[model samples]
Structure formats: structure tokens, C-alpha cells
Target: MKDFLSLSIANLLNEYIFVYDFLDSYDLKLKDDELSKSFREFFDSLDEDKLEEKGLSIDLLKEQFVNFMNAMTADADTIEELESITIVGGVNKYGEPENVELTIRKGEVICIVGPTGSGKSRLLADIEWLAQKDTPTRRQILINGKVPDKKRRFSIDHKMVAQLSQNMNFVMDLTVEEFVRMHAESRLIENADEKVSAIIDEANKLAGEQFQANTPVTSLSGGQSRALMIADTAILSRSPIILIDEIENAGIDRKKALELLVKEEKIVLMATHDPILALMGDRRLVIKNGGISKIIEVSEEERQHLPYLQALDEKLVSLRNQIRNGEILNE
Candidate 1:
């Protein structure tokens, strides 16, 4: 009866929540009414006699929440561990086939857009299996149209899918030069040192003059961190596919950063709620209730409709550069 009740509750939760897979993929524990009950019970259990007259402060609560989130992600050491990647329309146990099927080509950017609770992260996870592959619920992952052997070195093959989460962090002790160099050192190419130096130079070019390669990551603003992460991932990666989640939240010159990624010719698959990021992709796949509701090529007409001011700004940049370079300005 206990087993049956547990299964019943799980089914009920699945039926209502819609995107239970997304929550589970991100390790976000869903809170139902039972969770409220549990919180209440725990609060009640605290000995009133031992309790201080003062209630819990907001600071204390915030600290506790931060601690909780960190603890949850403690085992997530590398970027790969955080990826909950999945392919579209993967086979599952329910005997029901997935309706959404997407074949992402190499050296292209595919943006995924959907409403809230649309299982975007799950889709990311399915395509890029990360640190938590040890569990029973594994991604039905495939690479280059073949099922990769799990027993083999997954990290090497996984280089194909570089996932950038919303929140990026770095070791404050390492300078930007040192940080990028360390990642570059791991490559197997001949003259690796020279290649590393070139990568750093390229990354710096994209990052711009204001942000120094020697600057500590701790001093960086949210926007700067995002830029650095992009540089690091873009330069160090030999990956064919890059997965980004809610990149618009980084509060940076997102268009410039995205332009750099696109220019690199890497196959980018971003999960974005922002239409601006959505427009950056060659194609947009809209997911709903764990299925693809719409898969459309971003036509030129659609591209023109997206905030025209940004395009105007790019045009102005070209005009100014042409004037300075003394080419088209005279014509």
C-alpha cells in the first residue's frame, strides 16, 4: 500500500506539473503542499523553550538558502557536470515516442524558445550529459548519429557539447591570462604553448581593452564574468555544439558576445527566454509540455522585425569604420 501510494503521488505530480523532467534535470526540488507541511513540522519541532525571543532574520534566511543551493551543486565541479542534455524526441520507458525531433548540424546556432515550465533545461541535458550521469535516469545520448559507448572516455567526446549556464564563476586566485592558459594547456596539439597564447589574444580581442587579462575574476561585474566565460569556453573548446541557458540574464553586451560565438562557426544551441537571443539563432525550436510545438527557420523578414535599433547600431559602426579606413567614405 505504501509503495502504491508513492507511485500514485508521483503520477499525480507528473500529471499536474507538466515539465517534471526539467525540474528533475536541474536538480531543482519541486515543492508541493507536502513540502509546506514538512517546513511547518520542522518549525514546530524547534524547541520553543530553547528558541530566542527574536525571530529568524531575513539575512539568516538568505544565508540558509544560499547554503542550500551550494550544497545541492557541491558535486557539480565542472561545467560538464551541470549539463542535463537530451536529444529531441528521445526514447523513454513510457513506450510513448517523443514528437519533437531536431537534427542540429555542425557549425550552426540553434536557439530554443518556449514558455515557462517548457523543459528547456531537460532538452539541454539530453543533448549534453554532464557530471550526474551516474544515476539511473540517464540521457539517451548520441554523438555523430551513433550511440557513444558510455564506458569510453566521455569527457573527450563531450567536448562537442560545451554548455554555459546562467551563473558562471571562476577561481579568483587565477588571473584571466592564467585561467585561459590552464584550459588551453590541456589540448593535444603540437606547439600547444603557442596555440594557447594565440587563443588568449583572440579572447582578449573579443573581450575588449577595458577588461584586462590579468584582472581577477572576483573583481568582475556580472557582464564581465559572462564575457570572460564566453572567451574561456570559446577559446578552449574544440566542441562542435555549445549549449547556453538563459544567456540574456547575464546582463552583458549579449549581442556582441553572441556575434563572437556565431563568428567562431561553432554549432550553438541556446535555451533562451529572451527573444533577442532567439533572433540570433539560425533556427528557433519552441518546446511546450516536453514536445516541440514549432520548428521554424528564422526568415529574413522575422530578423528585420526584431528590434531594428540594434541593427541600426551595427550599420552605424560599419559607416564609422568605413570613414576611418578611408575606403567607402570617399565613394
Candidate 2:
């Protein structure tokens, strides 16, 4: 305890400079307090030789640093969440008025179905961007029944949404671990080793072929790429609402991807054409003529057949793989 109490800033600079960013984000400045003052003075008169002579250990420094940070940022609730998002009536593309009013709560999944150019993506964009009658759809979005402010709309750090678009192309030449590392570090997640491992594990569950940390991002197939991003978004992204557009286009496991996000208690809004994908939602909106024509809550009768549908989908995927491998079908 004496050695820990006497830990000098020189030791921290020499060995634990990586913690500087974490400290800076929480504004953990040293001042008149005994420990902070001592640390401040030690830093002011940093001496490498004296620091070593004092027998200060990196473990002690980190322990003190963590305690300081935890005390600094302690809140009744650290996790950010939205109670619900409500979309009020907005104008459609034909300059006609839409009479749609829908509310989506946390842990609920909603699917959007429409033909091409029918405004499914527009509705999603409205929810994501928090449209205040500003975009093409002229939609009014509310969070917890009130219009979201400009700070909530523009602040990237406090983002309310995460999107998984149709394409999952990897332009970067990085390993899987490196890519997850980049994202984890950006959020400054504590215990990265455990978190990264959990993310990789969850991603592997959704992908047909398991990929390791050393796997090159560019070499990952479409499904693997989508699965990786979905896992990353679910595990790391602070955004409570996750938007998926045509996820089946990436050849991802539609149910698992939806299940992953839904299980995380995130509000999932997806625009899809596949019946299997659409039926998975608790409720779905059907759009026609650039307006939400109807909202249908999925019945127990539909969910009853999901197991059969899942088996059929899996078999279809197997057939697809076999055909791609140049195996001929037997009639």
C-alpha cells in the first residue's frame, strides 16, 4: 500500500501512457485532493530513476487510475437508452399526406416492406436522422413523444442509431482482430480482450464459416462480413436503435442477425423483401404509393411455422452452396 501510495507520474508516463486517453475523456485532472495533489506534484517533478527507486508498479498505478476514473464518472445509470420512438404522420412522395402514426419500443422489431421506389428506405432514414419534416419524406420523428433536439440529431458521440446497409464490402486491408480493435478502441471499452473475444464468438455463431482474429478482412465472404459488422454493432455501438436495409442481400442468416440485435434490447427497423425476414418482425408496415398502407402485427399462426421456414431456408442455403461448388441437382 505504501509503494502504491507513492507511485510517481514518471512510472505512469514510462509504462502506462496508453491510459492517458481514457483519463482525458473523463477529465480526471489532479488537484487539491491528497492523491490527486500527490500525483500532480509527482508528475510536475518526474524523475525516472527516483520512480524506479520508489518501487512503483504498473499494477498499482492502474488500480489507482481506475478507482479515480470510476469515482469521477459514477452515475446512477451509465447505459444510455431510449424509451420509445414515435413516427407521426408525414407527407409522401406524391405530395399527398400520409396518415401513419406508429410507435416502436425498445426490444421490439419492426419490418418495412415495399416495392422498389416505394419509400421504405425513406421511412427508415426519417427515424435514423430524426426527420423534423426536413427530408424527402417530410416525416416528423419523436423520441419518447417529443421532437429530438439538434444535439441529439447531430452529435455523433451520442448517436441514437446504427445502420447495416445492403452491402458489406471491405475496402480496408486489415485483420479481423485489427478491425474489431479499431472499433473497440474508439469507444474506449474497458477490458478489450474479453469484449473482443465475445464479439468474435457472437459473429462466428451467425456466419457459416468461422473466422479467426488473423483472418484478413478482404478475404471474408459476404456473409462473414455482414455477420462481423452485425456483431460489432450489437456489442460495441452505443446506439440503441439498429437499422438494417436488405440484410438478405449480403447472404446473412436473417433470423440470427435479427435475433442478435433484438436480444440486445435494441429497437430494430429493417426494410426487406423476403417473407421469412418480414414475418420475423413483431409487426410490419406495408408501403404502397409512397405511403404506409397498413401496419400488421404478426399473429401466433405465422410464428408457428417459423421453425419449418428456418429449416427450409437452411436447406436452400445448402443447395445454393452446393450449386456454386459445381454440383448438379438430382431430379
Best by TM-score: 2
User: For each candidate, what is the lDDT?
Assistant: 0.57, 0.75
- Candidate 2 on 182-251: residue-level lDDT in tens? 7888765568888788889999998877889899989998889999999999988888888888776335
Candidate 2 lDDT (Cα, 0 to 1) = 0.75
Give TM per candidate.
Answer: 0.57, 0.73
User: What C-alpha lDDT, on a 0 to 100 scale, does residue 299 get in candidate 2?
Assistant: 96
Weakest lDDT window of 10 consecutive positions for candidate 1: 1-10
Cα misplacement distance, residue 93 of candidate 1 (Å): 11
